[model samples]
Target: MTALEIKEYIQKNGKIPYVLESIGCSNIVYHDNKDYYSCSNAVGGDCNNPAAINIRNNKYLNYRNYTRGVEYDDGKDLISLVQYNKNIDFANAMKYLHKLLGLKNLYKVKEEKKKPDDSWFVFSRFVVKRRKCVVNDFDPMSEDILNDFVPYIHIDLFREGIIKRTIKKFGLGYSYRWRRTIFPIRYWLDGTLMGYNARSSIENCSEFGISKYFITPGMRKEINIYGLWENYKDIQKAGYIVIFEAEKSVLKRDSRMDPTGGAIEGHVLSDEQVRIILGIGVEEVIIAMDNDVPIEEVWNMCEKFYGLRKVSYIRDKWKLLGPKDSPADAPNKIYNFLFKWRIPYDESKHREYLKSLKKNS
Candidate 1:
């Protein structure tokens, strides 16, 4: 019979037993005074019980959960019922149901399109070739490496006391061959090393065609927060965690995580990362991005954590400090501002802070 004819016959007579017989289903049983159809694909020669459908109530029973049946609407089609019971894609399930009913190619149905093969898209085709620097690979946590490079690091970027404390606390190291300071990125507190962020220590390195910052290739920076592995326990202890842009800011604040620079604009927190923060039982998240970052960019970063409702943006608090200054640049001023406002853990505070800053400026 054609698909249209079978559909019309089922609608008119409601002969579910006959329909099951036509679809090659056998060994039907009646339980709870209800007709139960056997699954056509039942294995072996033993048909223990009816675990396919309950025609009396227009319900479909999954073989996995025979006791609990799913009821269908009045006008639900056979293809959808089969798809639901079989747990297969729409097109393939529809085709299987249609063929089982002895329906020919009478109806015109759109065929599923094949996806394009992405195996041809390789890294070499799109990656730009550049001059490779010979980096000395050493254990990031080795005492010898730490002792070798720590002496060369100067406290020119941040204060002497803060730098020394941060280096010891975060396992910060340096690479003499690369002429860059090393910041180890870990998965959790003392967890596996994911990668490293290397910042050039040489003066005028950018002018000499040396990139100031270099992230390890294949590192999933988009989903990671720098310093989170080390400071998660401290964050739980403090009841809240501060957010910053640069790694140095995380060190300067001593209880914060940086999304590793440039993340404020393009790489905001991912959903998995948010769940990680929530799992840590952090009550509030305060963002203190660079003072030079645009207000719109700060808003974009704030929007990433909008659903959390415990995030507060303190970018406006740093306005009076100066242009392009970060929390690390003036730690005392930022600290004093945070202490004075006592920024509440409210989402609306961000808007209020922005409004007050604009009004005063």
Candidate 2:
């Protein structure tokens, strides 16, 4: 689609039945070997195929991409992008997120000025070396890796397929809050298959009160967001993303949060993650954390990096609907409040909103 055609051709999918259908969401369950993914029906597949989302060399944290100033995927809690690169700033941010997550040095990589046609910096780690999912229509993994490399207790959204069945056939699997059969998998931003994060189900983890859900030995939440690369543009266009506390938030129909794993919700940003934000060249960053604890502390942190001018907050009004630990008490209600944000970014409106919250509190 041409740049002009995007406004018309930018296809969109409204609510569809959550089932495996090629016409719907390219559903299947089986691997094609040669590192190509094996897919299956979620009804018969393992819990969910865990694609090895190799930030490969990049890094991530809480789902926000700093380098390109965009959110990556639609799922809110995914690992950094391994397969495809979207939004240059986001891909670049993931690289630094990797570093920030302690997957690499603390420094986020600096963005260099380049032509649009220049090698998209996001692909540098794998494109030149031909790592998994870097090649289009080329599956570069083994069934063993597909079945034994990924862990999903932290990152939830699963892709549909047989791998998802494998988990359920035996009685255990995390359904992708969004997307398809999870098993070990990977893909590019254009939605091409890249690689998978396959893993063994937690066969015996109840003793420590640990759910039997299996996870890789070393996947770190401090290191990456689950599916950031997929939703980079929306984040940029939206100018801000509403961070959620749980990975499941990405799957459920909650407008207050990013179903794409792009929102940044947590206690605070690490120094490295903070630095990653600068790397992206973002002029504004509105901290939209849930009003769980000290908004003041969070405010201090925001001021440290983005300044009071760029910060914004969504006062936790979970009580507006009912008593609970979620905005789910009234998802639509919360969403309606945020919907007004879709308009252009105006300073006066943000101030009014903030002042109103302060008076109410």
Candidate 3:
């Protein structure tokens, strides 16, 4: 059957439960006289009723209690709903539905178009709005103030010796008046301090309805990856870069950079960022995200870098390790895994890995 024919059948039949069941959605239940299906992929398996599609009206009320209702029309709308709920792309959604219906070759699913270059968007929204630097207004704090703040700020990091090293290596400082620890964010090209990210020292600030993290006025954290400037030389020397999700994770694991803030679902590598990495002659990229990060996210990242660079990821072996744990927690184990997989660290090894990747491809 064609996609249009299948869609028409579903619309006419008006059996939401059957359609959901065909896709292996168990735990289907009737609530409030409406058929609600819970997606296994949903965190905690608590699919809200609003995400349910109404068979009678042929409309998907996705989070309708909070958002507007999206009417289900053709297969495209169904694909969209599946993408929204399952966290997969349109093509994958189509493939999944088709396979479930035992009609694998029924539809020709067009791939989603890539977004336009975001460099200009980022620059206009972030760079142009950056506050002018006042001469001698925001210098680093004095040693005496820093020493006093060190005890209150990241005590665990201080104990582990990472805090002092990060301060020395990245020229991090404490702002006495601001009551924040400042980490200078630099430009990758010239290592110039373009802005700084200030983290509050007060542990309960967030609990008390305060912002724990603050960026320089008009600085968009999403546009730039943290630690990229400081670690670019090491990344070039290593021929591969290890990417983490948090700036603290980068510091803990000695990773090259974290994605602006953290990984978002279905986040793709921006063209501008990819160009910069490629320009730097990075041969491979290893995503070493936290254990709780979904495998789908890892696959999404791999797909973004596919054919452009050799991409691999570190698999979490220990279930006890929480999302906040970094490679520094078990450096020896991570190193052993790298060695076993022959992840490149030097020029010759990089060439070998590239050849192997190409062969496999």
Worst 10 residues of 3 by lDDT: 257-266
Q: Which tens-of-lDDT digit does each residue in 151-190 have in candidate 2?
A: 3332323331123333432122233321122432222123
Best by lDDT: 1
Alpha carbon lDDT of each predicted model? 0.50, 0.34, 0.49
| Candidate 1 residue pairs in backbone clash | none
Cα deviation of 33 in candidate 2 (Å)?
A: 60
Clashes of each: 0, 95, 0
**Candidate 2 lDDT trough over 10 residues, lowest sum:** 1-10
Q: Which residue pairs does candidate 3 place in steric collision?
A: none
Better of 1 and 2 by TM-score: 1
Quick one: ranking by lDDT, best first?
A: 1, 3, 2
Task: List the candidate numbers ranked by TM-score, top first.
Answer: 1, 3, 2
Model 2 residue 345 CA deviation in Å: 14
lDDT of 1 at 330: 61
